[model samples]
Target chain A: MTRTFKIFAKELRDYFVSPIAYIVICIFLLITGWFFFSTFFIYNQANLRTFFTLLPVVFSFVIPAVTMRLFAEELHSGSYEMLLTLPVKLSDVVVGKFLAGAAFASLMLVPTLSYAVSISFIGDLDWGPVAGGYLGAVLLGAAYSAVGVFASSLTRNQIVAFITGMVICFSLTLFDKIAIFFPAAIVGVFTQIAAGYHFENISKGILDTRDVLYFFSVIFVFLYGAHLVMQEKR
Target chain B: MIHVEKLTKFYGSFCAVDQIDLDVSRGEITGLLGPNGAGKTTTLRMLTGYLAPTSGTIRINDLSIDDDALAVKKLIGYLPESAPLYHNMLVYDYLDYVAGIRGMQSRRKAERIHELADLCGLSGIMHKTVGELSKGLKQRVGLAHAMMEDPQILILDEPTSGLDPNQIVEIRDIIRRIGREKTVILSTHILSEAEAACDRIVIIDKGRIAADGSTESLKQGSGGEHTIHLSLLGADFEEASRAIGAIDGVSRVERVEGANVDELRLRIFAGGPDRLREKIYACVKATDWIMVELTQEGKSLEKIFRDLTREV
Candidate 1:
């Protein structure tokens, strides 16, 4: 566990040293901030429900960009050889990189707390849904980044990683809706696996174990897949 | 100390490393000499636990590589070829990250980083990003990375593959210095590199050991044959080669080209260690030839390597 944290720290520091982290943070804030204000002008509501809605689309792009270089560049640069030879488990490297991407996503969401603050000043506001929306934001980030890390592990090209991550996340985000076109029996099954279904349940200002576990499951499955890919290299 | 028994690795149906056995004692620099695609890297990778062998037992001081992998890995410091590193990181930051992973306390890590900085001659460029440094500096940083934990065994894969002559000398000097305390296993295709640095040499060809011994012993073992080089001025290349081949002790004669056009240099391979100078001089006296140079050449390590691995 401690070794995992050490790798986590190194990857986080790598993001800061390179321009990727800054560019990712900038793009994330820019698109989300534009959507929040544009929605606030038309609805004039104290709630940030629409603001939370725009985030999935923004994160679908930002999260992949953040995680694209994680494993892909390591493999391409041959640093995977160096990392594996260390006295650390493959799980450590996978979890460490996953946490780094999730942490960056959470940090990228920190500035958007101003949306909650500004909404509070404008009119009567319910803190429950606003706080729940941010919690949901983090959960969504963790899930998206997991898929991103897994996609990055599948190839050595960052562009391929990014595109693959986008496709997977988009499918997961819209699968349940697309399933409406399928037979009624399988619709429930697709609804259960779609990320939007769980994000919707959490965005309702409730702390439900089912919704939290759903997100955790998504994070686990992808991270475990990434771990298997790394082991195959060994 | 390390013991490997019948280590084998196959990529699908193709055998990259056949069943092979080796023993390495403490404090000896052993070089795995082989041409490319000869399973040198594959062998080292399995030993370091970077790649799992298809079938084998690798025991380091009685602990198998599979059972106690983390423990075995802790005892090994490997520097892969090309020295892959995080180019975005400063030299100090990268070393610090490596130290952190090794579980060193921060204060001790700082002190040890400084020690490695001095040892690797990386004092001045510690703050520079790794991407900005030259190939030599990157290799030095990689050396420092592998030495961070001060492991008992050091594995280097082609440590001086891409360096100029001067850089090669510097890296080889560091390897020699490190070999005094740690058991080192380095792989190289450069024949002279193995001859110059290794205490023992294991020449691998086509995934098997072709020869294993110290430089002197290999020379002596293959040195049973003698070579007599004669530079003749008045003899034709074909006539001199045929005449030398006809000598009693001479097994084969090769005309050494790339010399002065008017002169022909003949390297005659003899059957035994006996001096072929007199026989060659007699043969020359029987012919209308001027013997400008006649010197008995000792068998070099290059010759020994060729003799051992030529068929492979």
Candidate 2:
């Protein structure tokens, strides 16, 4: 919708004009890029498997830090009330901020492309798995950002939002690995719902519509929850 | 035009706004005056469709807030107590974004932005980021954004709350100018501001209407009775009090200090000021006192406000 795009464009512009977005982006690249080089040199491998494996763990903290202030800052500064009074719908505001966080996450992935390009020079690189890994990382980042936004809606403090989002994302990421100690029947169901299960399949060049649907559904559920939170605030 | 009937909002078990009725006609400026937590903001939010009323109906130009929220919102521009703004955004860009969301065409957006910027005194700060601007400038920018679409109604909640005296005057002038063409509901605790800007004042106390009328009418309604100040020379204080209190329409008489020892001052509570001087002079002539000066003490708006809100 035109209204959604208008909100999206403004949100994106706000990110660039302020130091918060740039600071988060710079730190994300610096830390991730360090791990990328360190893993490649230590392993002496031409593949990006190490980088892909470590991304979810690193993003569990960084993505929430990036998305924590999306709605929380707006509410704290009284801008949420202003936005609610406008002609736009609540869905537009939720989707706009979600897309803004997704766009920032996408930018974080753009710099990692050079890692793919660098590995190509060192040795023979299978672009198939590497491309799939990047796709998986981006989708994972999208889902994480949505959850972060939902947490941000629950409170007006950015720190609380960040911690809450990180906890939720970390729980979802580690739930499957932890469930293995339990009974097999319980573990199977938990793993199916775990973020790592779907991400691992996509990282290995497996294009499962079910996995994509799962990621989208996760994004939708959190975003819808954020919408509900905002409506309750009104 | 706006019509609100039996509007109520509850936060769980606590009622923020009770059942209230009001009508705002086109091109009329109405003032909503109340203390903090008196539900002025909540009521305004409901009118703007930002908050749903617990029970009631709000019809703006005959469009219900529930059924036609978007349509109703499009016809209203609201400025909350704290003008919501993106601090990182340039004024022009922010207004442009609002214009786009309000469905203005790109071609006409520039012209509308320019017009609003000029009207709100924000043309000089069009390129500056909002965070870098002063509070008054930021408020001006908010005003610019609210007027970008030129809606038929403007709802301003304490638009001049934190501004300096000069800024307050400037904002009041702008509001008065805009109110000529647009129906406006200006909310404030400043009675003088309402008296200066609004055609009618709706005073809400404890989630209910305490008084609703023109400034003069409300003052008269709450004044109770008139008072006359009398200064007399060579008069017996007790005898003068008794004589003045005996006059028809005069309720009570109380003694007050004069500038000199020989001078005696008395305040007379009466029906009105008419013929009070004659009655006083006649009463003083019969006695051995000289009537020095007598003047009617007009009732003030402050007294009316205090009387209306004070517990019975």
Candidate 3:
């Protein structure tokens, strides 16, 4: 457990010291910030529905970009062997890197909180939906980051990692909307697996246990797969 | 202490490391010498608990690598052939991170980092990012990171692979100094480097142990035949050669041209050089002619290594 935290701290420091993390955060903020305010003026509403709705779509690209180098670059640069030779467990390394990506994604969401503050100032806003929306967005980002980390573990090239992660995340996110064209029987099963289905439930101020479990299960499945990939390299 | 019992590793159908049994006592510097693709790196990885052996057992400090992996890992510090490092991090920061992962607290981590930096001559470049450092400095930082934990066992693969001459010397010195307190297993293709730094050497060829012994023992064991270079100053070169040939252990003596006319070089094939040397001295002393030079050349490490590892 202590080793996990130690790895987590170093990974976080690695993100801060390198330009890749900052570039990712800056791009995410610029694009998401513009959409948040623009949607506010166009809709003439004080709520953050526009911000929450746009985050999952924006994060599909940004999360992969942020998390693509987590394990891929380490393997490419030979640092993966170095880390494995340490006293830390392989599971700790996977979890530590996952937490680091999650933490960075959380930080990127911090700036969007000001949008909530701005919304509260202008009109009567129900804080319940806003709070739930942020929670849902954070969880959605975490799931995408987990998928990105797994993709990163698949290849040494960071660009390939990014493309693979984006493709996987985009497919999972858009799977529900695409199900509308299919029959009702298949649509029910597809919507349950789609990230958008669970995220939309939480965005509407519903903290369903099923939705929480769905997000956690997705994170677990991808993280477990990442662990398997690393073990295979050994 | 380290022990391996029939350790073998296979990558799919290809066997990278064959069944190999070896051991290293505490505080001894053991050298694993082999040609490229001879499984030196794979053996080191298995010993370090980085790769699981296919059908064998490895125990470090009485702990099995498979069962007690974390404990085994904590006892050994490994430096791979490629000095894997976070290039974006400063030397000190990277060492600190390693120390932290190795379970060192703040005060001890700081003290250990300083000690390792001083030991590896990384004090001057502590603040520089590893990416900005030269190859030598990067190698030193890798050594420093490996030493941060002050592990009981050290496994270094090609520690001086890409360093300059002076840097190699510095790294060898560091290894020698550290070997006094820690059990070290270093692999290198440089024969002289192994001869200078290792207390015992295990030469591997084609994924098998070719030779394993002390350097002196290997030299003496392989030094059966002796080459005697004689410089004759007067007449009776033929008589001198016959007298020397009658020695007890002398199997055959062949004469080759010397650089000067007064010199005659004899390549002596003997059961042992020690027995033949005395007869040559006696024969030369009996002759009334002056003997300019009589030198017995010892077999070089290269010759011994080649003799052991040559493809049959």
Candidate 3 runs further than 4 Å off = B232-243, B246-266, B271-274
TM-score of chain B of each: 0.83, 0.85, 0.92
Candidate 2 stretches greater than 4 Å from native: B229-246, B253-267, B272-298
DockQ of each: 0.68, 0.78, 0.86
On TM-score, the leading prediction is 3
Q: Is the docking of candidate 2 incorrect, acceptable, medium or high quality?
A: medium
Q: Rank by DockQ, highest first.
A: 3, 2, 1
- Considering summed lDDT, which 10 consecutive residues are worst modelled in model 2 chain A? A9-18
TM-score for each prediction? 0.90, 0.92, 0.95
lDDT of 3 by residue, B123-155 (tens): 898889889998888888888878877888999
- Maximum-DockQ candidate: 3
Compared with the true structure, what per-residue lDDT tens digits does model 1 show for residues B142-192?
999999999999999999999999999999999999999999999999999
lDDT of 2 by residue, B1-312 (tens): 799999999999989889999998999999999878889999999999888999989999999998999999899998988687988778888888888889899989999988887788887888998889888888888888778789899999999998999999999999999999999998998888999999999998878888899887876766458888898888888888888888888988888865689889888889765677788778778887888788986677667667767767
Q: Ten residues in a row with the worst lDDT in model 1 chain B?
A: B303-312
Docking class of 1: medium
Superposition TM-score, candidate 1 onto the true structure: 0.90
